[model samples]
Target: MSSPLHTQPLAALRRQLLSRDISPADLLHSVEASIAQHDPAIGAYLQRDFPTALAEAHRADLSLPLGGIPIGIKDIINVKGQPLTCGSKMLAGKFISPYDATVITRLRAAGAIPFGKLNMDEFAMGSSTENSALQITRNPWDLTRVPGGSSGGSAAAVASGTAVATLGTDTGGSIRQPASFCGIVGLKPSYGRVSRYGCTAYASSLDQIGPMTRSVADAALLLQAIAGPDPADSTCRRDPVPDFSAALQGDIRGLRIGLPKEYFGDGIDPAVRAAVDRAITLLEAAGAELRPLSLPHSSSAIAAYYIIATAEASANLARFDGIRYGHRCDQPENLRDLYDRSRAEGFGPEVKRRIILGTYVLSSGYYDAYYRKAQKVRHLIRQDFAQAFAQVDVLLGPTCPTPAFKFGAHTSDPLQMYLADIYTIAANLAGLCGLSLPCGTTPPTAEAPALPIGLQWLAPPLGEATLLRAAAAAEQLLA
Candidate 1:
């Protein structure tokens, strides 16, 4: 028989722990058993420390805020004494984190246990876990399809009942896209809203760590534990964190939801469009006033995002050059050869591709033409959101253009894979808070399996309270 705790939401599990109906050790064991039974086929974890987690569970304090919940950490985030591989062979066994990230410290203070290092795209550069040098994490909804990435493992683990909740980093839709694909809830807190001190940098300006859970209330609970300014990170915002759980109580009676006309264009899949349309109707019926809006710069987001993200990636990934730690070449003919061979052998294809593209855009002569032009366009995109927010409380749209695709479907075509993030890249570009939840499901056809559809909600910076309130109401009405 399955453990009832495995399927219970995070809020319910906390209640059970408070009532002494389920002990932390029992919860850990139940998760371990589920992982042992399901993970080989699902591939959601890169590494797990069951013994350490078990030891922690035995001494857990149930009176704390989290009630000893077991949460999965994305491999890119540092957990003291654990392997911080970032799903790349370059740092695979070479570096053990010497300290915990700020978010990990906050989680521990809240009584949440960091249980495992979940798989991700190597250096968080790809749209699918297939880019991981470590393992391929499959979507729990359909084993043959990808759980959208680079946060695929976190999403897959939660969807498969191996975890109650997990943390994922979003650099251009990594968290929300996967949550959409796996039929779960994922949030990318506004840039600077969550500390990035110990997270492996992807695109520093774009990456924000957030929660992945089965419900909006659970996401709120996790966010409350980790969202605050950290002294170690200069980019972290100093705004006081709000009571996100309390925010979920009020209905979105007078909320103004903007439906961007650009998102429903010709390229979107028919099923996805239909599902989002239904969601808009449901929200409208529940007292949210829907208005058709325009983000004129939306079409140029993908192009600008690639140039900026890759350029930041190129600068951030220079630390892994095999000098101090990480993998090194056996014997170098010279200093140049050492740098060349080590990087070539250490990085996977996708990482190499992004690095090269980034370097090209940042090269001396081309910087003004490509990188500068992209930055100018990025400002316009942010301005577009600013104008839209002046008229609406939040913007609503489809999370992805389509449901999860089969493995190898877009592997050979980088452009195709990049376009998959068309609907989500703008939020990251604008540095706005975004959330994705299961709005509906597509029917199975002879050629494709049934898959979940997600509705994305975007709010201005530090507007998580409004975002969660609106999302929770929609979740309840949809249910």
Candidate 2:
């Protein structure tokens, strides 16, 4: 029998824990059982800490907000004494976190248990989990297809019912694309909205840690637990966090939603387009006003994002040079050989490609031509959103251009792989909050199984209250 606890939403689980309807150990076991049955096939977790989690559950404070809840953390986020492989051979078994990330501390304080470290693309560098140097994570709905990445395992764990909710970091579309492909809710909160102190850096300026869950409400709860300033992370905003769960009243009457013309044009799959279009219609019928808007710089988002993101990634990833920590080459000829060989042996192809491209753009002679130009374009994209938001409460689009594709589909073509994030990248460039949720599903074909489609909602920075409210309303209609 399917365990009700395993599939229950975070809010329901919280209520159950608070009321003593279910003991914390019972809840943990339901998740443990689900993981045992499904994780081998899904490959969502890289390391499991059931003993530690079980102990935590036993002593959990039921009166706390997330009391007794079990959560799977992305391998990039550090948990004290846990292995943070980051889906790469570089840190596999060698790197152990000595402290908890700010989010982990917040979750623990709110009474949640960090059950395990989930997998991801190596260093969060790819669009699919296929790039992970460790293991492959498959879509729970169709095992042959890929779960999107670099947050693939995060979305997969939640979608497969192994965890009630999980955390994922978004640089470009890492969280949202995977959530779309896996048919779950993913939120990429505004940059600086959540602390990044303990989460391994990808593109520091672009990355924001957020929640992946079964419903918008759960996403809200997870976000609430993690959002706020961190003294360790200077970039994190000091703005007071609102009660996100209480904002999901599902009433969005007269809300203005913007439909971006650039997002609806060329390259979007017919199935995905149909699904998002249907969601727009449903929202309109529920009393939202739809207005056609133009984010003129949208076309340049991909180019600028890659240049800027990789430039930042090149800087952030330079720390793992086999000097102080991480993998060290055997019998190195000298320091130079150690740096070259260790990196060569440790990084996956995608990570290497990005590093090279990033280094090239940031090189002295090319900095002004490539990196600087991209930064200019990034500014324009943010301005486009500012102008659009002034006229509408939120912007709507498809989360991905197409549904989940089979493994190896885009691995050979890096540009094509990057394009998979076209619809979701602009939000990161603009430093705005974005969400992806299941709106509909495509029919099965001879070569491909039925896949889920996602509708993306974008809001102004710190506008998650409005975004979640509208998403909750549309979620009910979609249901």
Choose the strongest candidate by lDDT: 1
Q: For model 1, what is the alpha-carbon lDDT of residue 108?
A: 94
Instruction: Give the local distance difference test score of model 1.
Output: 0.93
- Model 1 clashes, total count: 0
Q: For model 1, what is the error of residue 267's alpha carbon versus the real structure, in angstroms, after optimal superposition?
A: 1.2
lDDT (tens digit, per residue) of candidate 2 on 1-479? 65557588877777777788898999999999989989999999999888989999999999998899998999999999988899999999889999999999999998899988888999998888998999999999999989999999999999898988899999999999999999999999999999999999999889999999999999999899999989999999999999898889758789999999999999899999999989988888889999998999999999999999999988999999998779999999999999999999988888889999999999989999999999999999999999999999998999998999899999889999999999999999989999998999998888777899999999999999998998999899999
RMSD of 1: 1.0
lDDT of 1 by residue, 282-383 (tens): 888889999999999999999999999999999998888779778899999998888888899899999999999999999999999999999999999999
**Worst lDDT 10-window in candidate 2:** 1-10
Write down the lDDT of every candidate, Cα atoms only. Answer: 0.93, 0.92
Off by over 4 Å in 2: 1-3
Candidate 2 whole-model C-alpha lDDT, 0 to 1: 0.92
